[model samples]
Target chain A: MTTDLTDSILYLDAVSVSFDGFKALNDLSFVVGRGELRAIIGPNGAGKTTMMDVVTGKTRPDKGAVVFDGSVDLTTQDESAIASLGIGRKFQKPTVFDYQTVEDNLLLAVEGPRTAFSSLFGWRSKVTAYQIYEALSIIRLGDLKYRLAGSLSHGQKQWLEIGMLLAQNPKLLLVDEPVAGMTDAETEETARLLTSIAGEHAVVVVEHDMSFVRALDCKVTCLHEGTVLAEGTIDSVSANDRVIDVYLGR
Target chain B: MIKFLFHRFDKTAAYFIAALAVLGVLIPILNLALPEASTFHIPTYLVSLWGKYLAYALLALALDLVWGYCGILSLGHGAFFALGGYAMGMYLMRQIGSRGVYADPILPDFMVFLNWKELPITWYFFDHFVYAIAMVILVPSLLALIFGWFAFRSRVTGVYLSIITQSLTYALLLAFFRNDMGFGGNNGLTDFKDILGFSIQAPTTRAILFSITALMLALGFIVARAMVASRFGQVLASIRDAESRTRFLGYRVENYKLMVFVVSAAMAGIAGALYVPQVGIINPSEFAPANSIEAVIWVAVGGRGTLIGAAIGAVLVNFAKTWLTGTFPDFWLYGLGALFIGVTLFLPKGIIGTLTARFNSGGKGDTA
Candidate 1:
């Protein structure tokens, strides 16, 4: 059960998970408020992705509570059920149905009747059309709507996956390394796209690129081991002695 | 319903149906109406053989519905096919009434030979044609429902799922071979006298059955095409490509798999039901894992994801088998192996797929 946490859209208190005797997330507590865009930065094994996994219901925490929208307990649900509750996750690698068209990828990801019969009958609605249109423009792939997703370039595929998340209409979006291998221009466009989306949705981004984090210009949380090591403005977190010692090679 | 059926209709499917319809009508006319001495006349034996191929094409189409579209490779589809045949065989045995060598009016010849005094309780409703048809559909679908529920619920997929499906058919094969199981023991059910009071061996009856088989194949193709053209089909393709991603996008993957699997099983059952009468036998040999694998090969040779391709592959491969076995019996298996290898190497997309790629659209991008 979730305790009333009005200030935060998501509340994770003392969440921990382990795999094969190795603790991936240990005593980690975090929160994201409604319509707030937050950035999480960490080294390779600092439990950044594991936290996303826990929030998205892909991996169950060994102990603790994950409350979403103030009261909905995310850990109690499975991946699809959790998604139905308006929580979306973008994987580190851009994963779309490669054989399908870009428009079809968004249409399949649209928030609607997820059951077999409803989808089989007719899942297309006005709302879905509007969302697909919006997503195509957002991802800047309007002309490529009919193109197979597999044929898209690497950066384009990344944008298409983001478009898929937008079509989902999620309340809280967990984006992992969204600009890992993008061109400089593509990264800049992605930053603008994500920034524009912030005021309407709670977006939590995890990345290793310091420039990208600075471009986001949001409150930053730097993780070390399995807990928050520093939390503040980008400059302040980067200036922290422990962060400089453990993450940024001095 | 009409709109939905026509919605997915394309040139390939249209041509497929046109070909089947021509064959359906012309085969009966050639075999029944024309004199046997005429060059245009087709012999009754060839008509029955082609009918068997049509039934097999239906089976391959059913397999393609799941394996090709949904990516659920079932290596035991023959089990469903065999179960359907057994249901039809039971009804045919009942039609024998009082014609057995032992002169028993109630029991079939095998039961009479075994000195059984009464029919088994499992055979209760099979005496009626309607009930037998229902069983032909229900029995396979029921088995698929139960099996798919447990396997998909637990997320057993890929090669593991294929292996289990093979094991399922093998287990059924072993069970049906036993004499005490009441399915005529190792001999299985055969020597059916009539169906709906029509003589089983009559040319007119055979023609009707052949026409029915062709019609069923066309219907199955249409249904499969409509499904793949729907939103549900998109979701299924997404599941096949990236299952975990589809789940994260909010689809109950197991339910979709279960629904398609059950539909596929019912189609296979119907194929089997038609097969028994045309081939004049139903036996445990139908449950062989090799037969199921052969069905997979047919789909692969036609085009794994293309419904029309699968049907064509089934007929083409079976025709080759019949020809090779008769003309060069010793080289049949080796030729079959080479065909599979050649398809894997040069025709990876299959006969129809490669042709479509070359003639229709050049790019990999599918038209909306």
Candidate 2:
């Protein structure tokens, strides 16, 4: 069946990716509407991350179309090109520039010229400074702006990574396990942050934390063996018998 | 432009430049003005030797630009250095002009010795100083651009990239050693008589070369400092720390790597060009992989990411080499190996890195 791509910010239709005969993403058809917030849950090796990979152009699917912003094909672009097309990703592990100051990390993410020459000749202008300041306050790390990113605590780094994504100001954000090792309070805060971010940008969050997903309070997609098993409200997807059998487990 | 260049100047950079300027002026005076019998008189030989050290320091600084901040461990940087040196060497060879044993005005003595009746096409513009200088910069940059383009685009990184760079220098070493390659074969280019109408052996000339070397090192240091201090530098450090994340941030990782790689090569080339005049030779041996690796060791010995540290490391290590080789030539290689091992073991951050960390007292140290 043909999928409608006109309205969705991201439309993945029957995308298949395999590695060494192992199907990482098998016929994974998913759509994220503009300004939509999505929570993807699955067991280990269930292709949730792989689906994000396919969307972000990190991995090229063996078959089917990966469209972005209604008509732009994502499959043909490299990661940087895809990112430049307004898709930002935060990895499962917090990957902040450790040696740089927290302020500099945010500065790098603030949208502007990404060319080497531009950067060499560029100065930190008022707009970038303001953007960084805003991001720092939002991430609650304003006081530690000058501190090295490596010195930040684990939770702070994750927030910093999220802040980096926000600074990027992409049309779509693919966050992977943002609250993986966070405390309950931090997890809730992250859920709030992701929720707050959704209305302006389509967000695809790959998460294993059920409570966090529930807290997201958005559309939920449960995957098993590379394809979508169930997708609906968190309550409905969690209640699905097959989702329970393969992911939630008895 | 001045403000942009000096924006990153910390106390260390200030001190480094101040010390360089003082030495640049003072050493030349002491050497040129002092009588031979005076105890304070610096010898011409010593002047040239120190000039050699300054050139080395520049090369190390170049390497640090790529390896330290960019995380590009180029083990073949000496190829660029040698290429620049050869360019300069060819100019020097042209200047010999009938002064050689063979008395061939158009060809160098080595070419005449090899019975080459005419100057090769590669030697076309060596007679012109501007052309030679341009070639010195262009050749290495072109090689770097081509080499970095393929390697970075293919995402060849880490030790694999390092290995390929090593092979690159090794390949150049073999090629330059060939008799027909027109670079004077394994004997390389030497026996210079004049540079810019001045006798190369003149004490005044030696002093001038030494001063110029110091000036170039300062220029290199400032340019490097400015680069690392800019927003572009932050991106490079990011790429160094996390390549994939930088890409995810929409940076063309290969493009960044390629740009820095080319710039670094050009710097190395300039260093080599300055070096050939001071040292009076440019041989295939300069293209040796070991030399590039040694340059890297100099950066590591000082501090990899720290610009001043790289310069300090180059001078300090070469100083040690000069002293040790003069005193105990047999054990110099072993000492170098041990020095590298010890630095890696105890001071992984290098001298400046460790010192800055200590002085920062747990505060943010310079240039993470």
Candidate 3:
């Protein structure tokens, strides 16, 4: 099969995954273009999270190829290898190391020698420090850098996880439900942050809040039953009869 | 390692090193310089016992490196300790030369008793102290590397990993008890004459061994402290707190586990090598799963993540064990059981953790 290599950073061709004979992903073909920000909106069981799992190499598709950066096959790599290949995923639930300080959380996520030997003896350079500082300012957790991540509020924890994702400096970022538990103000801030991040790196955000999606103001893809139901601007997609029926009909 | 120690010397770590240094100096003086009749003088037997305790502390420190830091709870650590002990025991056995009961130049007495024709090929290079020392570190590390590679790569963790580790030590126990294993079977290795040409029973040698044990404990603490303070240590702690998160952050979690597991095993092996010389014997009992469990309890009681706490837990619990087993005899195990239960329910953070929380929070407890 001849695949278009230059247009997209990630392409999933008819990807299908089943768990114990139950289809979680059903022949879902999708693509995310380079340096593009895409918002995925869907109902509870529309397979949004499963689609993310497939991209992050957390789950394998029984059929179809997940091509990354045009030529790299994501299906052939494990989670760590996929992560190291410049793809970072933020989970739906915030999962920061609660016991460590916020600064340390960022440090652990920093791109450098990740091996045991290097960490034991590796020198932290000026560039690494500057990157951590930049991340801290981006996440707005500079004042609480020394505080344990466990002590942070839920919204703050979500931001910290996002900040950690930023620290990885990946070419692609898969953020799942970033504003799920966030307040209105925090959600708006996240919208701005992710929007600003999109131009420098390709970002795929799976979110539910329509206002937040409107705030994103990017190309929106509405999913239903593990396939793309609608793809357009926020207003256009929301105005689609099919998209409206899929959200309200079920 | 020294750089980290000097740069990151905190109160807890500093106290640990100071205590070791003090003990190292005072014990040698009390046993050698001070008159035996003086109340301040330490008896020779007591010195050896304390030396054994220090070695146990080192073992506990090693356990804390993996368990407390990286969250790999290995209950088969005693097997590594015993393997290192056996390596040292082999060298000592060779030192016995013609002094053994059978007086065989090459074969140890137990091998002669078992009617073996010659020294087993596995025991060949152990006659050399350097080779024995190398084996003392290498054998346990190699075993840990292989075991951790399989276990971590398969994503076996928590209680399942603990169970497999326990099974490993139990397996070693059974094998070492077998006559055909060529490790002296049920009797194991004992009746040592010398180590590196120094008389094993000499007071000066015992004092030297005690000093060496203390030095080793200090160095182990420094190395472990430096490790946990490093950036690598940060990732390890993250893994302990959230394994999948660390994995998705681009860390090869299994490789990290294997590395720490092998390092901890090597440290445990060194502790065992020091232990055999001070205790003058190496037996299959050292490989008992219960011994490993007791070591875990020591870490729990002292506080798991605190390196100094583990060392303190080992020395204090073992000191109490020596005292209680003498006075109350059968009550010792019950006391230990109660302590474990009490620590779990009331002091989940253990002694050091609780104390630190109090100190840090000014007794508020919430900050902890």
The fnat of each candidate, in order, is: 0.80, 0.86, 0.75
Candidate 2: regions farther than 4 A off: A1-3, B362-368
> In candidate 1, what are the lDDT values of residues B247-328, reduced to their tens digit?
9998999999999999999999999999999899998999999999999999999999999899999999999999999999
Chain B TM-score (each prediction, in order): 0.97, 0.97, 0.97
What would the TM-score be for candidate 1 when compared with the true structure? 0.97
**Each prediction's TM-score versus the true structure:** 0.97, 0.98, 0.96
Better of 2 and 3 by DockQ: 2
User: Residues A113-232, candidate 1, lDDT per residue (tens digit)?
Assistant: 789998777566445477788999989999999898998988999999999998899998999999988999889898888999997999999999899999999999998888889999
Q: Which pairs of residues collide in model 2?
A: none
DockQ of all candidate complexes: 0.66, 0.70, 0.67
Query: lDDT of model 2 at residue A126?
Result: 48
Off by over 4 Å in 3: A1-4, B363-368
lDDT for every model?
0.91, 0.92, 0.90
In candidate 3, how many Å is residue A250 off?
8.4
Which of candidates 1 and 2 is the stronger one according to DockQ?
2
Q: Which stretch of 10 consecutive residues in model 3 chain A shows the poorest summed lDDT?
A: A119-128
Task: Judging by lDDT against the true structure, name the best candidate.
Answer: 2
Locate the minimum summed-lDDT window of 10 residues in model 2 chain A. A121-130
